[model samples]
Target: MKIIGNLFSKVLILIIVLFTLMPDASLVMAEETNLALKKEVFVSRETSGKEHQKTTDGLMDIKTSSKSWNAKSSDSITINLGAILDFNQIVVYEYSFQRANGYKLEISNDNISYTAVKEDSGIIASTERNFRTNAPHYVGVINIEKQSAQYIRLTVTEVLENKVSYIEEIEVYNSSDPDKFATEDTSLNASTDLVVDSAFGFKAPKVSKTIEENYAAGKPVFVSRETSGKYHERITDGIKNISTGGHAWNIKAGDYAIIDLGNAKEIDCVIVYEYSHLRAKDYVLELSNDMSSWTTVSRVTDYVSLNGETGEKSNAPHYYGKIEFDKTSARYVKLTINETAENKVAYFEEIEIYNKANKMPEFNAQPKEEEIKLSAPVVSESIPYSKEKFHIYLFIGQSNMNGRDNIPNSERVILKDVFLLNKEGKWEYAQPYPFGTKYSDYQGYNRYSSVDEGTKNGLNSASSFARAVTDNIPDDIGIGIISNARGGTSIEKWQKGSGEGLYEEAVRRTKEAISMGGTLKGILWLQGESCAKKEGYLDKLNQMVTDMRNDIGGIDDVPFIASEIIQSRPEGNVTIRKISEKIKASDYVSSVGTNTIDGLHYDAESQQLIGVRFAEKILNKIYGVTVTSDALLASLYNKEIQTEEIVPDYQFKIKINGKYLITDVEPIMHENRLFVPLRAIFEALNSTVEWEESTKKVTGIKGPKTVVMHIGSQNAYVNGVAVQIDVSPMLVNNRTLVPIRFISESLGAKVEWNQEIKTAYIELN
Candidate 1:
């Protein structure tokens, strides 16, 4: 029975041994399989060639003869070497009889096709003669994408004139084993020593007993030592040191220390300290994952200076503060004193690392959805003003219609003080503000207002009109001039339902003013320059009047007075005649003639005359007051009615290939036989009018070209080319009228007049 029991026990022990042996066998087979999968082969050419030897001092000298060459005549030297080899790297050395210019190094797989690997600059010839020596050359370091290469070539493109080139050495290294070609093991002490290349190794104090005692007592371990002749203390609170100057502990030349963070933590910052009085410098702080393969985090010179200036005296301690890690997964941190002060040592009192804060809370808050509503302005009902009691004039159109022509001075008439109601409902006087001022030489002629000339002029006119109308009626006349004008703006831009452009904004503002309290009386329409450029000028003008009348509380039929655009200068009579024709035909709109001394804008005298004409026409229709032309003439300093010879039966005849076409008119022949007032005539001719105040020129466009006729200048341009006309166009009575027949035919538009309808018409083919 005892023998049987002993045998059973032996059997059990054998079973346990076999189980352990089975795992070992499997592990060995697995390692073999892994090794077999990593197939790599290394090919080197050093052994077969003439061997060049180098000394232990890291320098080499090689000698080669030209007779050792296998020369080819195809302008390329091909080296067929290792077979079935995986090409990884190549190195070559060459010596020349003379200075070589350069050489192209190429690599190939099939020995036929080649790719240039590197181009090397030739070395200067050495003074040592007998077989000239050049500086040692490292030809090419290539990383081949494909693993196999059977042949490589070096083609010398340009060489120094009289030299024979001899290769001293060529080495090709390939690896079939990946592990052999991988980065060298740098974690060894030999590698570290090689990196430092110095003689010192670090040591530290014995703290095992103290650490064990602190762990038993559940308290932090403290290290106190005298370094650089000063006593320093360091306390570790598991992961970090809470005490100040923790990293400031000093150590001797060959001394080292370690701070165990107790557990793995995300390290955000690390601070270092030096000896109490001496500054620290030339040190390296590194981190490691497995207490090996350390990465240097920071290195700084003594007296940590950012701008390379020493801060030793600045009370700022010579320490590296807040050393951040690119990642937070490190377990061991190592600091090495690379170099230090000649007399003072390096030290670190305590190290600290912080984990980042939680960021998930910010992402958790989501805004609740809610209904939204868009608000729009409420249109108010219009308040009617009796014409017999009070008159409200709406000064509309461009800069001239606005009142930029009047100079502001005490000599000028002050009718009433005008104020603007700001968005906040505060009343602002029309005094000199930063944006608007006449005293600064920023006037109508300066184009500063041309961008929005009509708007600027409208504001000035409204202010002046307020002063003038208030002077006559006093308290009874609460003059409200709702102006809407944009300088250089065309009438088409002001059309309703054309999304709010500059002109639309003007019209909107005017309507808003009228809705608030402004009473409708007369619309002083002073715009035509933009319409003067197109063929359908009258139709567009008629459209604007119709649209504006419907928009401004249906005040279309309420005495709309049109101011004829003033001619620039030099030929004022011709422009006046053109303006007169339009005014004479439209009973609802009357012409306010050009009343300026210089002609660009209406002067004070002209402004008063314009006001009188507007008031007479409006008051007569609204109040049944008969305001005669004689009565209007009496108000103008009793100036005599300047009459010229009336051109009776004067007509324009257009013969296009012998087919007669009569030009439509209210092209009335004003005194001098000049057929004027043909908005339709100019429109049919495809001529556009643009007024430039700076040059005082009215420019006309035909097709892809321009013609500029200055007010005072006689020379004109046809498509930027200069030409002369018989009569220069001018501004008369606030109207820009040109000679009908002369300008019409010159612009390729035939002009003719119908004697039966008393009209002028233009025809274009």
Candidate 2:
């Protein structure tokens, strides 16, 4: 429940105490003792979970695993030793992913002021290129003539080109002997090994050629002695798919981890997967039958960090080193690390012995799914039945408002008269996504929806709210959704006068929805993920609500509701719950349901439950209209289910000048010519249009230009001149669909067709 991070999200901490030192592990400190252990570590900026405490955890003195302090725009790390010590050496390490390739060490006496160490005046940075091909040089050690200081600061001045900064452990050693820790040559290939974690083979399977079974996995592992890091039992635990840090047995040079394969058997191939960042170069492998007599299998001595042997760590971190030889019959296999690829310590993720008996874990690789184009049902300007009220709501804020529910074509919620604002700013019958899913139609929605490589990236809170609200109201009444919710946006963006951002975009969409005929009954605010840990969110949110009321014309007494975010963000949840106190009518729904694709975003069932909760608050509190809840309806609908039917391949767009021609009826392609609704495009061209239902004819008039066309007729009259057209006029969804090219050309406007993006541009005269 404790979230240890910066006081303010993304804000840098200059001077603060973040940790309390634990009881002293060592009674007296010497050159062999790590003075930095159980001390306070202060970083400029650290991400959540990767706090500054990890830097002084004493896992590995110079090499780090997943236990690291990941920085955000970090500049330096200051370690407080609690008391002044005459230390001669300070060792700092970079991470497997974030490589602080260059750094400088500074000492502070007052803990407020600092000066560079006397041994080094310039920065300690490596000029090596293609660090992936060669092991990354990520160590910065300064052995100064014993200086008395309480605080030591390591400033990461330069980073590996295009790489981030992740600080691992920092070790300080005090010595009475002056020549204890001297400045050693650090520009060697076989000394320091650090690289990217996203490399291909870090957690992926890499078996030896013609080898399928692993005889050592899940077997008992016995190490000769304890090493630097932790977890010795992981040497035999399968390590192909999971790459967690602080795992595996960390052994000093010439130490061995013995994997007991239950009983002895014939073993031909031995593959060792060492920690990718700190790979072991030289290792002594032997086979033991009775723990006394042993046959030496292989002793690696000249391994050059696997630079040219495998793919670079930037692209593919070679997790395993394969050794295939003649079959050796032995009950036990001993892997003794003689030398490390980089530092003095080495760790193994997995060690597999092949004897053609036990098979590895089952791996089922699912290929990425292909997206099929789907066309939603054609929505009319207004519903067929009338005589009822039309309520509207603004679904605004962060990712929770914009969601993904794996609702199939059957569970996909659809009401009779509910509507969703499309990405082109038009209205479609209420469904999961109002904004078009395709990039060519509405690219912005696709940007957020297709972020994850999963199938459940559809559905929002608005559709379910509409269904619940409609059930409470009259049968003929309907709802139109003005959805402009952007995921991961802070409340600051929604505040009015924020300038040219989501604020302006939300106001524009609301105005468009309002202009189409509906009341802005309420505003649904579901943001604050970006600034979850920050303070002053309640005041900012109040300002945004007041501004939205003033700027988004009409309905001053409308209800404004905020939903409680996931329990993970407790601070943000507190702020959201406090909004009800600010606005008398507004309500805040409690966080509910599980089944999230990622633990962050709410899943479909949860999204549906949230929708119903919001609607319940609005209907009972805002409208003062409540009905006894049907437990079955709230949980699962037992009535006849309504399925969603989408007309396939029924979309094309018409752009006049530069702006999109937003219309209720979208343009369609027929007979190689684009057919758009006559009224919308004519009005865009400063032309007046008239339709005759009896004759099935339409006429467009702009200044002196006049064009006439009849439905299902191939001949058209423009300025009283008869012209033969390739495609006839048509009627679709009760709207007069006309050939756009013939109409634009007759009006003397230049029309250009772009096939790549599937749009027709018209330059009006």
Candidate 3:
């Protein structure tokens, strides 16, 4: 009996000692419950520099120097007074540089020992200069993770060639563990507690709570709890240590404490903890950047009670709780404790603070100027067109097709029916020709015609010809004339794919037309001068025709017609013969010879005759009209032997010094070039024509007014003032072709170019 009593006394003593060292069981339970609470820390950099070190006052400062240090150097430098800090991340901010080169980062635990963390050989640490006031600076971010060091050093490997390297700032942060942190809570805490009932009717009473221990200085605050009373609340009013002004009651299973933050920088987040009890609803969290502006972060209403009796109870107690802010800028933070059930009370334990983080600057580059010019216009809707029978004609090839004649008069023709179909399937009608003439004939539309003043007449002539031919043809005939003709331009230009050359433009226009729902039929080619001047005339012509045919989708053995070039004079027959021979020899093309009084252009009669001839030969073939023989052409060329008396269709009567003079007969459209019979007109105006063949131009001097005309260019000079002519001047068959009617009438002379006899007559008015 004595031994058993001694053993029992020893056991009792041991139990007392264990009880003393174990601390209060309730306090241990409170700590265990709060351990599941989560925390976060956010750090932001706001300045530029290389070295960012914490000062004795705990404020961070960035520093930089001019000395270039090798970042890849094995030599080490120690940082003084370092601590063992658990840093999950480090971000280095750098400015713009031509290339990324020369930068190193090192960390050290002891002042005597160091470890190289990051050694980048091609890290350029420089801020780009902004010449334009609106140009933005470039920035780079260097992330250092899984690195254990208290002190960090950045060393430059190589200095930039022309620019200086700059670092804006560096940031360090400790990552938070989410599993260890609670995202929801059920206990009644002041910061996150929300009331739903009035069972424990607490009237407009402001309650407060304090968390006195185990608080990190710069960690995010989390909260979780529930409430029921009508008027219960708490706030964290600029007090980081403790809260006052609330009754300290025996907190039961669901009671809560409240904290109030006074006027300060905005509160980004708040935290709360429930010691042991469980509740059903979630917590309500609110924040304020300014005390006046309040934003509710979250509401906690759905929670599972971990400590319920059967693990299926509706409101069991829990320990861990957390609430996070959506990275806002704020100052004052507050919490409210709602009343619980009659016997239930809320519990509270911990609070934390998170500093506001900085944001990175955005960079967006601008687009180039040339690209802006090439952007196609937007089309709202497509025009309705038959997809089955839309035929596109691609008119490609040399100068004649390019239309290098004179500009037609404005009264010449109103091309109402002619239209160029745009990519959006919309039609754009051709404008009236801007010159002074009486031949206002309707013509088919021509696209991509030369705009140079000299080419207007030829283009107008072509238009008239096309209109006459297609008038009764298929309405589905969509003509896309990609006339990329340049005078004195060679086949090489089209072959070279140079700037604005006919080949590229032709291809582009053809593609555009086709994309707009037009099917390419054939290419109307009329170029050979360049090839004729050189040797490979046949080969070049063949290649050009073949390429065009292939590009236009190889439609029905694409037929090409070679227009026989007229002579500079009626006697220069060498070119005509060459053209005829080449056309007759080629299997894919037909030849149409035009009559020319001059070596350059065809007269109106010749133009009509040639058009008819071409229409008969090529159009007939296209229309299934087979020619039995080539005898008719031979007969027409050989049988023209009679000379008829030239009668003036219209006579110009003018008063020259009040004297009526019927001047000598003048040829209207002479040498394939239109001549104004300037001598008669000038004589009528008391002036004379001065010829300068060396300049390929003519000058008419009449009473201190000098009107100059060039053979191939659009602009003319009248008395030293530049005048824009509708049509370019031309020299045909040793005759200086001038705009007779316009010049004569404007210079006080009445003149006319007769259509019947094809002669020009002028008189001074």
Q: Highest TM-score among the candidates is held by which one?
A: 2
> How well is each residue in 1-765 modelled by candidate 1, as lDDT tens digits?
999998888677666644643534433433221111112112222222112111111221443232122112213445555454555554343443333345566766776687776666654222222221212222223334434556666554444433334444444555343233222221211221212212223221221111111110111222333445332324222112112233345555434444445545555445443323223445566666666577777766543222221122212222334444555656655555544433335445334444333110011213323322222222223323333443455556655565544233321222233434323222233332223332322222112222242222311434433443443343544444444455555666666665536445545655665555555666666666545534655556667666666666656566666644542221222233353344322332223333442224455445545555555555466555565543554543455653222222233333333233344343334444454433333554666777777777776667754566776556877666567765666665555666666566546554455553344455554
What is the RMSD of candidate 2?
29.9
User: Relative to the true structure, how large is the alpha-carbon lDDT of every model?
Assistant: 0.42, 0.61, 0.41
- Model 1 CA deviation exceeding 4 Å by range: 1-391, 404-411, 416-477, 497-500, 567-604, 628-765
Q: TM-scores across all candidates?
A: 0.30, 0.38, 0.28
Candidate 2: what lDDT?
0.61
The CA root-mean-square deviation of candidate 1, after full C-alpha superposition on the true structure, stands at 36.2
Ten-residue region with minimum lDDT total, candidate 3? 34-43
Candidate 2: regions farther than 4 A off: 1-375, 385-388, 404-410, 433-457, 627-765
Candidate 3: regions farther than 4 A off: 1-388, 406-411, 414-418, 421-426, 430-432, 435-447, 450-461, 474-482, 496-500, 530-533, 568-599, 603-610, 625-765
The window of 10 residues in a row where model 1 has the poorest summed lDDT is 209-218
lDDT of 2 by residue, 601-649 (tens): 6665566666777787778765688742233234445533222222112
lDDT of 3 by residue, 590-674 (tens): 2233332223444343444443344444445555544321332333333242222221222232334423334455435433434
Q: TM-score of the candidate numbered 3?
A: 0.28
Residue 126 in model 2: lDDT: 28
Question: Which RMSD values do the candidates have, in order?
Answer: 36.2, 29.9, 37.1
* Worst window of 10 by summed lDDT in candidate 2: 126-135
